[model samples]
Target: MAVSTLNVQKCHGKNIEGWSMSITNLQAWLQEEGTVVLGISGTRKYVDSVTMKWLIAVLYFQAENPNAALSFYWEPLKKAVRVEGHVEKLSASESDEYFHSRPILSQIGAVVSEQSKPIVSRDVFIERRAMLLEQYGDGSEQLPRPKHWGGYLVVPEVIEFWQGQTDRLHDRIRFRRPKSGDEPDGVLLHQGDNGWVYERLSP
Candidate 1:
């Protein structure tokens, strides 16, 4: 997606140096422009299962909070729409197909590692690894995709973008609404050049 630059005068008590934009706003704009399935690139930190679970809980809290910025009906907008659900497991055939397509090392690692579970000793893990190696012998054939590993689809109900400026004049934009028409056909984009783009803000 092409990013459009918006000039701002001031943001966050700083002078606007140059044009800036908000990622959330940009996403909202794109949705309005009839684009879906945006790909975002970021670092993937290895989060333990507990951390992941906690993160989900926090999201749920914000999602359920009535006064949060990300809340769906906050007049001034509080939070992004939260889509929650269990990870769907792939069918046996689907799992087999995906496993064969994965890198051999990944397959082996998945087979050997006790995901989302505690391992007491490195030696025990190594022993399990050696045992799997002996059994699989290089993982060339399709090894079943782990049952714990699956997928979840998050449908973003709102997307906002903000761009930082030199003097703290950041650009902010938001996209959201009744997602009714066909895909990529009825998305709406709202552009906000100044901080006062949307009305109804209290002093």
Candidate 2:
């Protein structure tokens, strides 16, 4: 999953800020200056790398051990889903609610580590975790959520489904918001629900 900060304009293109976080059953990270590429498949080439704070984000899901051969020497199909979207920062109250719901140890980890910053050694985290554990180990004490910590919501504008084929003519289907002057002729582009459009692309 890709996430970007809201309200901070023009982060350095190379530096992306993020930290590992687990909520409920999902684990994700935040990227400060993430890049999102547009125009996956079509005649019009849009090869620009868009680096913006809130304009782009992607959620990618890939299969595990897809390259390995299956039973009877059959090759397994490699599949992935990519979603690109606009990012919106969650409200402070919402952030607080999610923060407090985390396990105590996870909460401590978030507070102990300063993401994208340099530290002399891993022992820094070990020591800090130990100290915090001693202080807030009991249920009586609660670790306060850091003001800088929060969450983001990625509203998808485009989504692509990909499947690898043995002939290398892999299948790709993209669903996205209809751009201005888009007309589905029912062959190359098909009209979809809620002002969306779908198209099959050449691999």
Candidate 3:
């Protein structure tokens, strides 16, 4: 998931100091910035989150994985911005590589346990563990990746950026792409394809 911040600029023909400005620029910014592949902590800092406070938006930007993004509204930030996207399970190759790299015991335990199910007790678990370990005996042989163990790729269809000020006044910027495409038209020219639009909202 991507966590991001939104800010306003008074020069953009609206009252940013008054906590309202069009999000055309903000949307463009995300489309461009979201493509960055920094680590989680690096992304947070690189996005310059300190520019916005009071609202924390979670954005899933997977440029390297898939070309998608997902933003969720924090309870407190719900009144600020709203965006949605789709998620896809990771591929078998990805899961298999990770499954085999785990410690042999964990691989065996994964084969035995049904994650997220209600288990009887630790003793029951331990009993199952003992049996699996005795049966497998920690061999270099590979174990199959359990169907349930895998990650997801998220594709964001729309993005909303928001900032807040005093007296419940706030600013909201929404960026939406057509269902058929993701490339956007913006202040800066993107390399290829253009299909995104932006709108300002009352807050």
Candidate 4:
């Protein structure tokens, strides 16, 4: 058996700011339920433009093995992105190699950014960035991926695709697990009309 529910809410007179706020509120609500997975669509340039493009990040409680969940979700995301004409996964060695390939300035930037979080002033960050560049400017590959800076994979139990239509009649298709079954095989497959039906979602 599969269980699902649709929630409809009106956002009358609420502007874009309000919509953004509502998303935060919804995240808080979902967190209370259990682990909540999120997906967001946006241009890469748009994400790269901002100092932090974390608007769409998966949130789950701090766990003993947080990396486990991340690894799970990351696999399918890599596949989905590839199917949509994007690059595929980077092996651990590949990831390490890519880190070494980064420019010295970029490596310094990563270091400086990690030390300066929740920044309030632009000039301060710029100065710090410049200072790091100068300090590490021998153009050496000594810098490594920051201890806190790495990728996490999330194994999604459910994936939902939402398409907007006129008059606010959106199209939503969710895939979840059946109430009774063995664990999903975790194989990603492309399906016509159904899109990617990798797993069954609990409706």
Candidate 5:
């Protein structure tokens, strides 16, 4: 397993950096702890006045980069899944249930870290964590979920599957909602189950 660092600049000036983990661990972490930093809180004030359209894309690697000192000449074979969707915030009750379901230490950690705000040093988190531990001395009590901390459900609009080939001829199949009068032509577009259509793309 290889450790990779991901740095991303989020909307509203929030940033994630120095996060290193194996691909599998990172994927799991993003589904769990990463949700805490999702930008719903920073834009809450503007939400009332503006139309909010929450969109999200999730990418997964099936066959990853080969482990080698030099891989430039290696076959570009790969497989991946890409999901694009609209997001809907979970209800307050749902969020609360999920938050409390976590381990006590994780709950406290969520409360201590100030999401993406820049910090002066590691001492900031250390001090904050120490203080929180002292306040919640015993693990019997559940920490209240912060207003900004919650969950979202992604309603997939388009899902794409990709496979890379050594001959430089990759394959891509995209599934999406079908338009009115849309019919599968077989060669490029094909009819899929449940009101969906799939089309292949040129590599």
Candidate 6:
């Protein structure tokens, strides 16, 4: 298993880094505490593993808050990969599959909600949801996923890890994907072997 960490406060920065681990532990961590920092049109958000399974693709984030920043984390790949490129939304079929997999109530809610739009009252939303449910569901029929709801895939350009230490002497490791065939200079650790480079940063 591997892990990735990004510091959103530093800007819309992302990194991917992780150590070796068993597949079982990897799945367990993902099921338990897996999380990532995200940015969308100036609003930085934190998407836990559960929420992330749905919103996979991460578009560039630009939080309206002046202090906001965006971050992304992932781990343990077969080969070294780079992030920080164009973000891609999921395909319609992919979106549909994900949507159908969600709870019926979630589908109904997403369909009924106006998203970021302001609402007049909770009662109106409740009424709309009830009506939509009555029309689309009888408990057996699988509801369709909302058109506006889907996932994003964030391919990171750099990967980093931070370990807190005594008195703020923390240990930070980073892996930056090379722009050219020439790999970056540093001691690269690859699958118990050396294939890529990783730099230790002063905290």
**In every candidate, how many clashes are there?**
30, 1, 5, 16, 0, 19
lDDT of 2 by residue, 1-203 (tens): 32222111235654342322111112243343222211111111100111222112221111100010001111364876655665445556866787887899988887887643578999999999999999988958878887545554545677678888889998989988899999999999999987889999999
Candidate with the larger TM-score of 1 and 2: 2
Q: By the TM-score metric, which is better: model 2 or model 4?
A: 2
Model 5: pairs clashing at backbone N, Cα or C within 3 Å: none
Q: Give the Å shift of residue 52 in candidate 4.
A: 18
Q: For residues 1-203, what per-residue lDDT tens digits would candidate 6 score against the true structure?
A: 32222323222464332221111111111111122221221111222221122232333221211111123333242123222322334466856775676677877876777544567888878998888888777766667665446644433445566655557686667665554566543355322123435677777
Give per-residue CA lDDT, model 5, range 1-203, as digits (tens): 11222223235766443332222111112342112112224321112111111112111110111111101112254776554544445567977887777777777776777654678998998888788777774865557787755554445566677788889788888898787788789877898988789999888
CA lDDT of every candidate: 0.36, 0.52, 0.45, 0.34, 0.49, 0.43
User: After TM-score superposition, what is the CA distance of residue 50 in candidate 6 from its true location, in Å?
Assistant: 24
Order candidates by lDDT, high to low.
2, 5, 3, 6, 1, 4
Let me know the TM-score candidate 3 reaches against the reference structure.
0.42
Tens digits of per-residue lDDT for model 4 on 1-203? 11111112234754222111111101111222133222121212112211111222311111111211111113333222101111112234634555566677766665566332356777866898787666667865366655433322233445555444455554545554343544445553323233334432222
Which has the greatest TM-score?
Answer: 2
- TM-score for predicted model 4 compared with the true structure: 0.40
Query: In model 1, how large is the Cα lDDT of residue 157?
Result: 39
TM-score of 1: 0.42
Per-model TM-score, in order, reads 0.42, 0.63, 0.42, 0.40, 0.62, 0.54
Instruction: Report RMSD for candidate 6.
Output: 11.1
Error of 4 at 116 (Å): 6.5
lDDT of 2: 0.52
Root-mean-square deviation of every model = 15.0, 12.4, 16.1, 13.6, 11.4, 11.1
Question: For candidate 4, what is the lDDT?
Answer: 0.34
